[model samples]
Target: MIKRKFFMTFIVFFFLFPLQIAAETIEEPDVSSEAAILMDAKSGQVIYGKNEFVRMNPASITKIATAIYAIENGVLSDQVVVSEQATKVEGTTVYLEPGEIVSLEKLIIGMVVNSGNDAAIAIAEHIDGSLTNFEKNFNVYLQDYIGVSSTHFENPHGLYGENHYTTAYDMARITQHAMENEIFRSIFKIQEYEWDGESWDTTIVNHHRLVLGEFPYDAEITGGKNGFVSQSGFTLVTTATKGDLDLIAVTMKTNLKNEPYAETLSLFDYGFNNFKTEVIPKGSKFTVDNEEFVAEDDLIYTVNIHDKVSNKINPSGVLSIYNGENEQIASFNLKSLSAPVTKNITDENEENWQANGFLGTMELAILGVSAIIVVLVIQKLRKRA
Candidate 1:
């Protein structure tokens, strides 16, 4: 009886415990969105997504593209003269009167924080001398930098138009590009923004609920942009971070009241509570025994990561060893680094270099001998191993 009990306990510990890996259950947020997606901004890993590739009107999310083009071409501190067309832009406005002088920085605040359609138009007109030319620049930037294939911009305001559309996946991709720039990032997170004594307040406080207080979830929402129109419904592009996992969520055509925001919160809860980021180091000097490895002052590798994985998940990364000509020599498990690794020969690592040199020479010698033996045997038996 004692033996049987012990055996049963062992079975449970080894078999059941291993299989008890946490799973990320995506609760379809109580939303009526036509398209949605959750992705890691850094790794571009999709956590939870629905109709991610379907294209639809982007609403005010168009400002993300507008902002990107402005950052690249002009300075934020530069003064802009509001044009008649910009002042007359329909819908949301920063109330810029014609010929009113404003800095490009204030316009960005209005564009992102206020979602001011007039500010977007003013900046667009200032950048390209006309809205039509600015839109041409936005489309080119979207194609080249943001990598949104299905996205097309008919206007900068994101007002309902014939061809103004983007997929959830494409919008997420656009957010990824926008987040990489510091100026664009800083403006997105500002809860309250002031522009020439006119302040634009957020309609729904904490566009990303996790970043604010008293939510059903906990996370560091880096920053985000929100959008809405009668045609596009409620739309959002939000960024959240927990541990090493940073994610971007996009929702389009959802209920304006609480559905999109609540859904995003739930998805983040699932992601952080159940999943963890797995950092798989591509190359380890200790394992590979290559003296030449990590010789570059600025080292970079082709890093591939599997993200939003269960805490118990231990995915074996695919590592292919190569030669000078990019020929595949061998493949094996890659060892991960627990801390930042310093590559190159240093005074402290003299012993490591000696050991690495010995190992490298022995490996080469073994290969040479094996090749010679195979060649000799081929002559003797007319066959070789």
Candidate 2:
């Protein structure tokens, strides 16, 4: 009777344990934004996403792409001739006069720090000769080089255009890519810059309130850009860091001015609380088929904080990371440290034999030709004798 009770207890415990564990999982954040995404900057993993791929107006956050593009393509020291059209652009301005000359770097600073639409126009003109050309070339660069497909910018400033739209995921990707450049990073993190424009000569402050510490949050606010138009609502792109984990959060199309910020903070809290960045250090060795492989660079990935992590290395040196449930979270190709060994054939190899058979057939044909040559030489010598 005691044994029977013990068996029943064991069954009950087994069934209930999984439920308890599932209950402990971190709750998903509740956000009011129409679209949002939280991404791990190191691994490009989407930690949390709500309609992240949906197209929406990105507002001033479009400037992040413009700034990075200008930094990469244009000479910073070159003086940009501010056009009359640039001075008359609607929305925010650095109050530039017609034919005013400003360094490309200073224009970028003003555009980013002050959300200056005029500076964006000047920078766009200087780099691509005109806004029309800038729009054409910039879209190609975003698709081919930056690897974002859904983002399309009709203009340099994020003022409302019917075709001017980007997804939260695309914005996160742009921010992630831009944050990698040291020059962009330096400019991005600036909370204030002294503007010496012809009409506006004062300290231009960043419009992102979170970046300026206007809100109370624990994470180190690295940099951010915010945008608003009646058509696009409020849009924001923010980057933050805590310990070894760096994150990019994008919130778009919020009704209120502060809603994007609130959603951003919630997303950050969820990421920081529920996940962590783990690095497989450089030179970490992996063995397959008695051949060795090593990581060429640190393989970084984000994983759930509570999950046990494991890795599987394939014969071709691809490392796949799995969580406790055996779900693959990330993968990286390792470098071969030794020459690849010719693996022995087995039942599992049969399926791939057709793919690999051509080389073996070529080797056999070469051997057969060599044998025929040797026999002909011997027969010719014998005939001569």
Candidate 3:
């Protein structure tokens, strides 16, 4: 009985030890938002997520997508003729009058810096000729080019449209894609912009509290957008950099205005404390069964700061990365430096070759010897004749 009790205790300890170690390696942050995600901007890896895939209203953060799309598709110097419908857009505005001619560049500044619904409409109409066409084309662009599937925008500005919904993960991805554009990055990080519009002429400050240093946070606040509506609660998208890590945090559907900001700070802390990004430099070579493969471009990935990471490369030039817990965290397709050798053999023959092993080698040796003997016999017979 004593031995049996000791054995059971040992089994329990053995089973539970690994679970405890894994839990201690990386700690999750306490977040109040309904949907939130923390992503490595460089690698596009989600270090932490909570209900990130659940669709929710994005509010005015939709401007990030709109600004990037317009910058890429439209000429900045083109003068846009504001329509009556654009002037009538509700929510925030640059106070454009009907028949006002605004440069596309200035409109983008107003829309991004001031969160102007009027400028959003004007830019949308200028790019696509109508709000309806802008909505359709913009959704397609988000899905196809930005590679976000769970996002759909009914308006260029995020209003209370029933169909204007996006997931936290999708918002993070959209922000990541937008931050890659130099023009978008410059505009996104602006703390204040001088507005010289037809109806309004004043300095427009960024609405994000952290970007303006309204909140106490340690990391460098790079860029951010904030939004609110009756249906969507408070939504925030923030990008920050600390050390070698660049992070994007998105929080949506918080009841209190300060809740999303607090949660964003919590997420940034979690990412900066527990995770890190590493790059496999371009032209890095990997070997699989004597075949060589190379990373055609720089491959970036994130991992828990306290965990060991291992990489596995297959013959097809696919690299899979795993953390200490043996969980696969990321994967990349590599360029083949050399073609893998192919063997033409049936399953039965392959199985026989494996199973016979030394016996198969012995058989080949015997056959070779027999052939040699036959040749020698023929030569001796010819000489005798």
For model 2, the superposed segments whose C-alpha errors exceed 4 Å read 1-24, 340-385
lDDT of 1 by residue, 192-218 (tens): 654453333334233334344335446
Candidate 1 lands at a TM-score of: 0.68
lDDT of 2 by residue, 1-385 (tens): 9999999999998674653465367698998899999999999999999999999999999999999999999999999888999999999999988999999999999999899999999999999999999999999999999999999999999999999999999999999999999999988889988777777779889999998999989999999999999999999999999998999999999779888888889899999988899988998998999878999999899988866678899989899998777789999998888954576678548757865797789999999999999999999999999
- Model 1 stretches with alpha carbons more than 4 Å out: 1-17, 20-31, 197-217, 281-385
Q: Cα lDDT for residue 289, model 1?
A: 27
- Of candidate 1, the 10-residue stretch with the lowest lDDT total is 304-313
lDDT of 3 by residue, 176-226 (tens): 999999999999889998887777788999999999999878889999999
Better of 1 and 3 by lDDT: 3
Q: Which candidate is the best by lDDT?
A: 2
Ranking by TM-score: 2, 3, 1
Clashes of 1: 0
Clash totals for all candidate models: 0, 0, 0
The positional error of residue 314 in candidate 2, measured at the CA in angstroms, is 2.5
